[model samples]
Target: MDSLTADDFFALDLPRHAQLIDGTLIVPEPQGNFHSVSPYVLAQGLRRTAPGRLRVRRQMCVVIGARDVPEPDLVVVNASADGGPCLMSYAARDVLLAVEVVSPDSEERAQDTKPRKYAAAGIRHYWLVTMDENNRPAVHTYELDPHTGSYAPTGIHHDRLKLAVPFTIDIDLTEIDRL
Candidate 1:
């Protein structure tokens, strides 16, 4: 079969998480318990802490290339994205941050593919969250180095996640347990 364009993938009427990467359609498997709740907690935390000009959304698609649209666990974008008609997907350039709560099924994509794509598309911030041995959220953050058009390791937070770039972020990852 032929590869699907981003438009082709997005136009489809589907009810669950999906992405178009390298011109192919990808439907992520149903998330496990932690996977389901962590993104929600993170999004809520960001919404409360981020500057008012930014907006936080859960599981929104970002268009990185003509055939690449990845629905990150959460996306942070400038308020301008909200001023228009409700968007089906936000352009990569409009995204301030792309976050992934890595599930077992998504480790490879979250750690590698998505970051590479995000950096190449000029998305300045990328974060990957995974459960530590004790089943706590460990946030790994990266910032784009425009000179090289690649991401640089910013920090890794264990019990709590904090950052200065992309707006001051302080999230008690433990909140994931409340769900």
Candidate 2:
């Protein structure tokens, strides 16, 4: 069989949550309730606070390479990349930030694989959300280090997340409990 390509990945009738990574199709297990709801909550917070020049979306994939298209929990892109209703994904250059809400099942990909790919794609920012000891949201932010083409830790937030880059973003992590 031929290896899956990004063009083929989009053309197939696959599950909504499926992803194409390194020419392989990966269908992750159904997420836990908290895992399932994290993106919605985070996206809601971002949408409400993001500058008009940016747009927030949930379960959107960024086309990083010919064989790499990983769908992140949430993606923030420039308003021009919104592409209206027909567009299914955004080009990597258009993505401003790629966010992954880490679940037990997805930790490896979220923490390692996806970040590497996003950084290589020149994405400006990446956010990884995980649960803290109290089972509340903790966001780890990273910015691309242009010299190395890798992400560097910017901050780790528990009670609240405040960032000036990618436009001002302030979120109360406890909001995850509402789910």
Candidate 3:
């Protein structure tokens, strides 16, 4: 078996869905319909409420380091002074909020894998949206406590939440569940 270090993984330019953690390659499962819809609804809601102040993107790759680039489901970036997408590679500092909508098959991916990685990457805000068996969604927001290297709950919105940046808008969880 071949042992791949983070450096080696970073050097490969293959264009498939993959992430490097420590020194291992993680192949992400394909996102399904529900997974796609949640981000869409959230992004649209955010954009409508906070136009020009926040940039919301779906599945945008955030380059935390040469060996660590994870495509978060929804990333809310600070409004660029130039009023355009911050085309430069995204870092922990640029991210105002990161969101992951859990797919039924990938609960662990959201609940565990991403939280740890985002914390390590120094992302200040993170959210994991989990869906019930019936596909009803529940949203959990985590704010990274830099000193502790852990995420602390700022709030849990079962129905709606007004995010911290880009704009102050309420997101309806029922609309997310319908998506």
Best by TM-score: 2
Clash counts per candidate, in order, are: 0, 0, 0
Cα miss at 92, model 3 (Å)?
2.1
TM-score head-to-head 1 vs 3, winner: 1
For 4-110, candidate 3 gives per-residue lDDT tens digits of: 65456656774565765444566776777777677777787777876676677777666666556666788887666223464534666677778888775556767
Q: Model 1 clash pairs? A: none
List candidate 3 stretches off by more than 4 Å: 1-16, 81-88, 163-167, 177-179
Question: How many Å off is the CA of 21 in candidate 1?
Answer: 0.4
- Candidate 1 residue-wise lDDT, 1-179, digit = tens: 58988888877886678888899888899999888888887888899898988999888899899989999999999888775556778999889999999888888999999999999999999999888887888889999998999999989898788878888888888887667
Worst 10 residues of 2 by lDDT: 33-42
Candidate 1: lDDT of 12? Answer: 88
| Models, CA RMSD each | 1.4, 1.1, 3.4
What TM-score, computed on C-alpha atoms, does each candidate reach?
Answer: 0.95, 0.96, 0.77
Note the Cα lDDT for every prediction shown.
0.88, 0.89, 0.70
Runs of candidate 1 with Cα error greater than 4 angstroms are: 83-85
| Residue 67, model 3: Cα distance from true site in angstroms | 2.5
